[model samples]
Target: MQLARIHHLLQVAILLAVMVLSIWLIGDVLMVVFAATLIAVILHNLAAMVERRTRLPYWLALSLVVVVLLAAIGGLGWSSGPAIAEQATRLRIALTTQAHSLRGQLNASTMGRTVLDYLPQSLGGNQAGGGDNGMGSRIAGSMTGVLSSAFGAAGTLAVILIAGLYFALSPALYVNGLLRLIPPGHRPAARTLLLVAGRTLWAWTAGQALDMLVVGILSGVGLWFIGVPLALALGVVAGMANFIPYIGAFIGAVPAILLGLSQGTREGLLVMALYAAIQFFEGNVMAPLIQRHAVQMPPGLTILSQTVFGTILGLPGLVLASPLTAALLAMMDRATPPLDEEDRV
Candidate 1:
């Protein structure tokens, strides 16, 4: 019996090792597939809505929705292309100028010089290969890095979008395939869990959209009222960044504050104060309101999810963490049995 138990333990260990190895090997593919699934979920819901209202076939409705969405995007881009391009250019230049000014100020102060001296040479753009044109070279290298990252991301996004279309086209096929992988005894529970997860994800997505919209509008109006340059661009960035929750707020605020600082210390302080007020209202009021109707994730758990997933898959993992957590929670709730009266007592 002892030998048998030891053998079983060894087998379990080996199985776990294999699982870990598999995950390590295919982590990128897994993330891509998961991202594709998220897109499919959104597309499926949209298609369902169209089908229900028009009494049309699912595929046809989905096709029409896709076309209309593409056309709408194209129309919007056509009308606002030049203005948006100009705003983006201005925002970039302003940020770069502000950064240089801040650096100059830092270099000019004795205390700042001390702090700067302690920093890495690479950060100062004076490392090897930096040469006489260190700043220019650094800028070139940074732009190259940005372009490469963007190019890679665009390719991955293209793959995800194409895969999403396929998944949305025949969701039942994939669902049934997944069911087939489950043991017969557990299929029913699996199906129920899937339903729960789907519903939870939908609620989370809808609420998140509402949250982003409110943040974007409020931020834009606030910045505009303060007479901040590139207010619209900053507001839009803030809104998009808010899609990531806690960390995103700070990420979005940095740019706006930097621009404010470029104007004056008073303006910077005002911007900071405004951001604080907005985030406070969002966290205390809007978040709770949204959570009550949508999904409730513990703050610590949300942060842990973001950290772990971000460590594993970078930005995509970080952005998907909250939604995935909600889905997992919903599945867990569905899977768990209610406490018996005796157990409760």
Candidate 2:
């Protein structure tokens, strides 16, 4: 019996190793699947909320949620699509212009000239105003303009949405089937693990959504009040980037501050101060409230997980890292009981 248990452990270890290697070697499909899972979790929770509150059938509630989401998206696009597009264009133009202007100023000073040498020449056109200048041209260029779409293509997006919908529609089918694979005695613990993970993920997602909305509102209102150009566009970028944790705040702030700097020294300082204040509010005021139900992920471990996952899985990995870590930590914490050491001998 002891030998048999050892063999089982080895098999489980080997299987886990193979899964890790597979994800590292060809992570695209896994990333797509993981993205779908996130979508399903979000949908399932929202539908559950709707079902309980309205005393509606789960399926009917889910259907209504889907329809409502689609309609909200369509309505927003119809009403504000043109304005968003215009703002995006303006944001790009402003970044390029400022990049060149900064480059020119740097070229004028000795230390600045030395610093410019490390950066890519593409940020600045052949002259102050010329074509072929986009902020995303080079990494050695400005950071803010480097934001790329995480959703790879239309087909992948469609697959994610469809798969997520199917999963959300019948999540129990998958969970129960997975539970069936476990040993009968272990099934209860496995179920507990799954429940903890799911609840953690859902709470984390909810907290993140709230954070994003607050950031968007604060940034938009603050920038507009300060007379920043492309305020709406900058706010949108900031809010979206907040999804990534600490690194994201820096990513969202650079372009706004740089553009402000292009206008004047005081403007630049104000933009910098604005972002600092926002970060302060998020970390001190919002984080505790947000973490009330969600697992409290330490700043250090959170960043470490982001680095590790981001390295392995790329953009999708980076975006989901914090939540994934939270789920993993919750599961680990609940894995066993704390008790006196056993004396089986």
Candidate 3:
């Protein structure tokens, strides 16, 4: 029996090593798959709602959900793609011009010139904006690479949607298969834990979606009122970046600040103030309201998890850190014993 136990331990170790190796080798692909799984969960919840409302079969409800989602995306793209592209073009020009202007400002004094000398050429010091520098030509040269990257992104998105469809349509199949891996005595407990985790994730996802929507709308309106150029594009960036928590707000704000600087120092300061106000509203009002219905993680834990995951897995890991942390917490709660009233005191 001891020899058998040792053999089992060795087998488990080998399997663990192989799993780690495989994950490292295909981290990007795995991230895409993980993202698809999250999407699938969200879609599944939507399908369940449709099923309840329409009294449709499970499969039919799932299909309807998928179709509607795809239609909405396609329609949005068809209608807004050109406007977004146009705004993005303006954004690039604004950024380039602002960079050149900053370079000139920095070259005005000895200290400024020293700073400029240390700064990278890509940021447009004396090296750029020269007659032979050809900013326009450099941008043109990069268009092919941009197009290729766009194509790659589109292909990855396609895979995500297709995989999401399968997972959303037959979530039970996958869930049941996974449950089968558990020991018979623990299967019931495992099922219960899964249910708890699912509910937590669903709540978190729904709340996050609402938060993103509110932030996007508020940002666009605020920036527009402040007379910021590319308000729509900037708002979208802000909304998307909000997914990463504390660090995200600053990341989203940088572009807006630079664009404001293009106009003047006063405008730049105003833009900075506007973003700070927006973040204040989001943190105090929006997040607390959402947390009432969703899991509320400690700010420190969220930050720590993001830092660790970001170090290990880069941006994709950082983006997923919160949700993954939530899921782990949910399962851990299930595994832990609840304290009695005396213990609590």
Best by lDDT: 2
Which regions of candidate 3 deviate over 4 angstroms?
1-26, 103-151, 339-345
lDDT string for model 3 (247-298, tens) is: 7888888989998877788888988998899889988998999999898888
On residues 234-274, what C-alpha lDDT tens digit does candidate 2 reach at each position?
99999999988888989899988987887788988999999
Q: What's the ranking of the predictions by TM-score, best on top?
A: 2, 1, 3
Q: How many residue pairs clash in each candidate?
A: 0, 0, 0
Higher TM-score: candidate 1 or 2? 2
Best by TM-score: 2
10 residues in a row with least lDDT, candidate 3: 139-148
Error of 1 at 65 (Å): 1.8
- Return the clash pairs for model 3, or none: none
Q: Please list all clashing residue pairs in model 2, or write none if there are none.
A: none
Worst 10 residues of 2 by lDDT: 139-148
For model 2, the superposed segments whose C-alpha errors exceed 4 Å read: 1-13, 107-110, 113-152, 183-185, 338-345
Alpha-carbon runs more than 4 Å astray in model 1? 1-20, 110-151, 338-345
Ranking by lDDT: 2, 1, 3
Candidate 1 lDDT, tens digit per residue, 55-127?
9999999999889989998997898767767888999999888878877888898888777777666565323
